[model samples]
Target: MALASLAAASLPTAAAAVRSRVSLLRRAMAASPSSSSCAGLAGSPARVGVVQMTSVGDLDANYATCSRLTKEAASAGVKFLCFPEVFSFIGSKDGESIKIAEPLDGPIMQRYRSLAKESSMWLSLGGFQEKGPDDSHQYNTHVLIDDSGEIRSSYRKIHLFDVDVPGNMVYKESRFTTAGDTVVAVDSPFGRLGLTVCYDLRFPELYQCLRFKHQAQVLLVPSAFTKVTGEAHWEILLCARAIETQCYVIAAAQAGKHNEKRESYGDSIIIDPWGTVIARLPDRLSTGFAVADIDLSKVEAVRTKMPISEHRKFDSDWKTS
Candidate 1:
């Protein structure tokens, strides 16, 4: 459809965005009229912030950008802040990724830990290049830090994005990135939260296990999605997981062209249980974030109303017996 014709379709979406913003405002007001922090606001479970970034090969530059954004999130009373994948660095070539890979407790994490401590905000380092066993491949890891600057949980990118698209667009993540074997969930003030990285967003089963089996209230998907794929599948995939799991979906994304080789799509978003895109950052390439108030009550409300997990027909669970 032409741009004018598309307006009709966007009308409802515009209305929905308004509603989401209003809902967030009301929730924020209810918890604390003036404060945005969990400490400042007594009753709120937590106020979360999601960041969208244009990261490049320069590690110091990326860190500086992240630091500025982190300060902005803290100023807004964001108690929990999540950043896009490859927050530490996004190199020019595939091989350069392994070169910059660092250990979990390396300087990168230490600096992020300090940021978390300074802001008094729980930080989710969406995706980092953690040094693997050999130089051949590194692990795309997600590290979770508590407000006190302690590492809480870390999940490696389980499903690598290895695809050969038309127009000679080819990506072999497995070429330099090792895959993770286990699913991970962590406890937070808000509730149990499940963690996953970019390509893992493509698999619904991972989310199913996180919600139904692991009992997660929130699902995290930190991505550096390709522009083409992200434009086509980003929102749909996010809403699907939120609706099916009845959990809040928090996705932080990398935006803009990182180098000559790659460009990312970023409409960094946080969707509610009923598949409503409650909060979203700009679709254009830039650095920004969207904050949302997560109420565990809403999770219970949605699950109670839909009861999809309770009504499953077949068992997809593993039996040790």
Candidate 2:
């Protein structure tokens, strides 16, 4: 089914940039005399930020960009900061990435953890390359760091990118990486968060398991989506997931042309429960970050009105046990 059918009917207009939407929200919040008067809410809004980068093969350049943007988010009072897929390095060729692949406890992970602690914000590293025990294989993984700088959880990209898109857009991630067999979600101060990497976003079942089975309140998609496909379906699919699951969606994207040949569509966005673009960064840049105060109460209010969770219909024909 087309993903747009599952979402609200609001295509973002040119006038509705992230900054303007946020400014309007702040004004509304200020205008309300009491927090209870707005949305009949119970808790304070959580501040979330996303970092979008135009990462290339240079490790130093990528690290510098991450460092600068993450610090900027922290200074702006973001409680949680997230990066894009393969934030460390995206090489010119496939096997070339193996050169930069490090262990889970390597310098790259350590640096990110230290940064999380220093900034006093929860950090989600999009996806990194980790060298497996053998020399022939690696794992595409996302690492979550708590505010205390501890590695809270890690999720490997379960659904590998093994597609042959027309016009030379062929990528067989299984060529160098092994697939993960598990779904992962972690608990955070703001809410429960489901974590997934680039290609995993296409699989709605994975997200269903995260939302329905695991009870995730937020979904994180750290991706380096290709320009060819992202333009056609990125925002629609993200909003669909948010509206259908009643969860906040934060997608940190790798935007702009990377090398002489590779290009990525960078329109990093944070969508609220009502399928609204609360925050977004520009399409091209070395360093850009967006912050939004997500009111968790909206999740409860939406779900209370439409109790899809309790009204689930089981498919007896598709029963497995």
Candidate 3:
């Protein structure tokens, strides 16, 4: 299917109308506290880092870039750091991704786990090319690692990028990647986080499900968005998700040319619940990270005033399992 068709099909009906309703913000607004992996750092502000990169087919080189960025974030006192999709490697040749795919417990991931432990920080390894069921395919997995270096949760990419760009560029991600059937949410000191990959940002219903069903207070969109689409829809789509879901949206992105055939739009950004851009890289092509403080109070404050969850009249219509 075409990109427009896929987008139109995935989106739910226009958001439900708001009704007059009042409810407890903490109790009624966000994800279940019980579902969180750790205690909520309620009153405190947690610092986060969003790393942007220009990854290529070289695994060792990418690892080195990530290490430098991680050290910089640690020096800035960031507690949780996010890396973009294809953080480990972006293939420059056909069959390279599938050839290099590894399991979650493989050496590549283990190295990243060690990095998190050594840095004493939580890590969102956005997209790893996990070995799939066959020799020709892989799973684009988004993994969350705790500060203790244990795997917290993993979400595979549900929405694949299979679009035809105007500039004679066509992507068929499904050709070599399997779509994930699960929606994953996990607890962190920051809040309950909804994990999604690059193309997933185009769909609002997923974000709604996160806010309503999973009670996600923060959303992670780790992407290697193409330069064309990123320039057009990336930030706007991110801000829309933040405002509509009443959640913080953290996007770590791939910037600049990765290989001869591909280039990414870099502008790693953090948006607040009110649709405000809090932190973004000034130089979009720079291999660096952006820092911001995640204030749960602000998340509560925004949802309390709006109370969209309680006021939504078509709750049954758009609710997802």
Candidate 4:
């Protein structure tokens, strides 16, 4: 069966597991707003910001770019701000990523945490090179920090980019990056956010689990996609996920050339549950952010009208025991 079709098919065990897990998450993250609580804000809209960046080998320079963007978003009254993958540093040479990998409690993350508190805004540090279990490998981790400078939740990118595109580029991310095993979702004032990195966008099953099982209303895809692939499939794939999950999708992207060998396709976008592009960066490779109002009522309205989750059927052959 096609992966897209498989995503629509029922996965009873996965659904149950996510339900049980999110229940525990609610108790743990007491600061997180509930869906019922967010209903009260239907009269008002929460503003979100997505940043498109061109991160290079200089760590300080990359941090400076992020800092500037954060200030801009905060000044604009953005409640939640998301940065692209490798927002901190995209190395110019091989093996540089692992050399600079740091733990969640390290100085690099501490600075970001402080930035969130100082700006008085929730931040999704879309992707960071996190120190993994082994010395030689790192995890491409996505971190969520609340306005109060607290770590809300983090998800390591599960799907690595290990493809040799016909004639464009050859990326073997798995060579130095350790794959994460778990799926993660978190609740916020905006809505429940389903966290995912670049390559994960290609897998719709993850989005399905987040929407149907974890009850995610917004999906985050932070990527540093190559120019070749982004031109062909980036927006198409992102819109498909939003349509399939019936959820809002926010994609923060890295744009322009990172180094001599690395270049990205930058088109940061905010999409509604109906697959409409609400906001996007005008200049593809410019370091900037696009802001949009995230209305949870829209999510509720769409799902209510369609009610596909309740109507999906399972093939008898694949039904769980």
Model 4 residue runs over 4 Å out of place are 1-43, 316-321
Please give the TM-score that candidate 1 achieves against the real structure.
Answer: 0.84
For model 4, what is the C-alpha lDDT against the true structure? 0.82
The TM-score values for the models, in the order shown, are: 0.84, 0.84, 0.87, 0.87
Residues 64-108, model 2: lDDT tens digits: 888777777777778888889989998997688777788989997
Q: What are the lDDT scores of the predictions, listed in order?
A: 0.78, 0.77, 0.82, 0.82
Give the Å error, residue 36, model 3. 8.2
lDDT of 2 at 137: 71
Instruction: Tell how far residue 26 is off in model 3, in angstroms.
Output: 25
| Model 4's TM-score against the true structure | 0.87
Q: Write out the backbone clash pairs for model 4.
A: none
Screening candidate 1 with a backbone cut-off below 3 angstroms (N, C-alpha, C), the clashing residue pairs are none
Give candidate 3 misplaced runs (Cα > 4 Å).
Answer: 1-41, 315-321
Candidate 1 per-residue lDDT, tens place, 183-286, comes to: 78777886778899987776676787777667788899999888777767888989999998998999999988888888888888888889998777645575
TM-score computed on alpha carbons, candidate 3:
0.87
